[model samples]
Target: MPCLPHELIAWKILVRLPTKSLLQLRCVCKAWRDIISGADPSFSQAHLDHLHQQVKKPYSLLIAPRIKSESDMEDPRDTRRPWADMKVTSPGLYLWEESQKDIATLLFDISSFPAEGAATRHGLTHCDGLVFLPAEDTVRVLNPATRQIRVLPWSLNSVAPRRCPQGEGHQAFGFGRDHRSNAYKVARFFHRETRGMGGLGMEVFTIGKDQCWRETAVQPPYPFVAGLTATFFKGSLIWTIDYYSPMYDYSHLDDAANMPCFVRFNLEDESFSVMTGPPWYKGPTILTPTLPR
Candidate 1:
């Protein structure tokens, strides 16, 4: 029997396997290991391209189920807070497929990197098959297919005032890739005090490079809606504009100026731009990706 050529094995056959399987097969031989995990990125890029072309339907759902900590179970005070039961021993991600409606498989767990205080489960942000899970003050980036995880540095807002009115001091986070540098970044928008004045500030952290969060000179035009995820598209993270608040100056506008808008932050330039929202649109709006025709 004749064996296939090196090019056929690397590009044609290996590129079609799932990430998890490829990672495991890396140990089978030196050639396979180099092709699967090496300094050169051509093979990996080809694999990603193949995966994208093969995906026709969105059947995968990343789920992080909330589990109560042992301390919460011992306390019979009956806490009514929603996140009271969010902390647990080992939080995990479950993948639900449309074909297997009743069965959800556990992909990985994050018990190794627990939050400092009570852990709050947030929605998972998916970018190029990577999952970004942001907790209270820590963020975890996970590759569900390979079960590899990275816990980012702690993000703190030290300059924020100790107390503020409700809905005034809000913090929102975003995760996206910078196309120019081909690096992934995590962005945080929070309330900060500068020169005895209150305003919204932003800080960014580059994964696999930055040791700490670097504060960006440019600030957000408007505060972000709390508990809403930012949409990543075309090298930018976009969020629905929150209503004008006293924290930032709004004296330049009248009552009619208050309306729904979009604040786009370019990951490459680290700048913000205000885009007008749909006219006569009412209620909440979530930014989502549309299939290209």
Candidate 2:
């Protein structure tokens, strides 16, 4: 009987082992299987967060090269060498470089690039070792360490294109890790016609049970005056907006008075507010927030 209790204790420790070791322990016994896969939300979330933090490392962001000349082909394969040649050394930023294989590969560190399965050629945003890819209507969340990808189903308003056809309107995305809930949140925004200048609207989506997505109510008082950039920060998706006057034509920017203003999104409250830039900074700038370790 004493031996049985000791064996049980050993199994308990085994189940909580790292992912690779846990996979091996799954074959030890049926009891081990049940214990390891039990529906303990807290335990599961802790394990996931542990795994995510363990592999968090600096990543490079690679952009697809634009074809500027007649010889430039739409096929990424045609200009692979140049894409592969481009690299960025910034820490905590995920970089994607075009590869000879015609796919954008994410290069971490200075070594090899991990091959990501059939990925859409879209813009990528990185946070806490997770890469958010906005591909048309779908957003994919990928873990570069494990090479696992999950597609998030989100409803995007089609009216955005029709309304802002000339200026490419605004699309903002925020990604963050929620320590309290042990879940990750991805939020996107599409501007709508509202009572404000030139009329603007906002929409939000959050991850729900079963790894699904749920749309939230439209947030009023859009964040930006002109352009939008969404990023994950401080356990919430943050939208950074640049302000502009409704009557001011962009062409008149040469006159210093036509400068852009700023706004921000508070994910927790689903609210909007003005964002003041750093005191010493001037001109157009992009801000990306770092998640707390």
lDDT scores of the candidates, listed in order: 0.69, 0.48
Tens-place lDDT per residue, model 1, 229-264, is 688888999876666444644455443334437788
Quote each prediction's TM-score. Answer: 0.79, 0.56
Tens digits of per-residue lDDT for model 2, 1-293: 34565345544554346765655665787765554553444554555556557555334344433223323334546655454233222222234433344444544331222222221123466655566666434566766554566777646453444455334444555666555555566665545444343344555455544444445554534344223335555655544444343422345445333233444455566666645455554654444433332
Clashing residue pairs, candidate 1? Answer: none
TM-score: which candidate is best?
A: 1
